[model samples]
Target: MKRNPRDIIVRPIITEKTVAMQQDDNKVTFEVAKGTNKIEIRQAIEEIFNVKVSKINVVTVLPKKKRVGRYEGKTKGYRKAIVKLAEGSTIDLL
Candidate 1:
């Protein structure tokens, strides 16, 4: 089935750890939609970056509790994908 561009990817999560890992020359990570699968992620990366993907690993993140003054709530859950590209392939999303 053809995947919607909107459903392809959500956004790049620029976190301190992610940035540190990037500087250390490790894997590149991204926050993807919860319903997106491994194959869909691979296709999305390939289509968006025009680069070859070697391997793709996905993980689900649980919600965290939030407290603001007297208000309390839970954050939304999400899915993350760690995309491993070919040795020479690179994506300049930064």
Candidate 2:
């Protein structure tokens, strides 16, 4: 399936750990659309960033339960992709 890059890649996850991973491992973390696979993610990222992708790792972020007094709800769960860029490739996610 041909999916738009913007639709596949929801947003960059710019937490401290991701920052460290980017700097140390040359990988970028992103919150990707649910039900997307590595090939789709690789295509989207490459097209959007114009960089070559080496490898991709995906993980499902399980929803967490939250409660306020008697009321309770579950946080939204999403898919995360860690994309490793080719040598000398970098993405300015800012």
Candidate 3:
């Protein structure tokens, strides 16, 4: 199924590790839609960020159980994508 760029790419993942990867390896991470595939993710990142993507890695995070005072539930599962930009190209994710 065709997916909109905005819908495919949920949000950029900004954390200590992700920031370090961006600086050292030219890689950026994003939270993507659960049903989107690698090719769709690559296309969405390229189109939305206007950057040339050289490689893409996808991972599925399973939901984890959590407990409150008197209740227990599971967090939502989500998909993550790591995109590597072409040499000499950069995405200003600020």
The number of the candidate with the highest lDDT is: 2
Question: Top model by TM-score, which number?
Answer: 2
Give the Cα error of residue 14 in candidate 3, in Å: 0.7
* lDDT by candidate, in order shown: 0.82, 0.95, 0.90
lDDT of 2 by residue, 12-88 (tens): 99999999999999999999999899999999999998999999999999999999999999999989999999999
* Candidate 2 residue pairs that clash: none
| CA lDDT, candidate 3, residue 83 | 92
* Model 1 lDDT per residue over 22-49, tens place: 5666467888987888988998888887
Is candidate 2 or 3 superior in TM-score? 2
C-alpha lDDT (0 to 100) for residue 12 of candidate 2: 96
Off by over 4 Å in 2: none
Q: Give the deviation of candidate 2 from the true structure as CA RMSD.
A: 0.9
Question: Which candidate order results from sorting by lDDT in descending order?
Answer: 2, 3, 1
User: Cα miss at 48, model 1 (Å)?
Assistant: 0.7
Better of 1 and 3 by TM-score: 3
Q: After superposition, how far is residue 49 of candidate 1 from its true place, in Å?
A: 0.3
Cα error of candidate 2 at position 84, Å: 0.7
Return the number of clashes found in candidate 2: 0
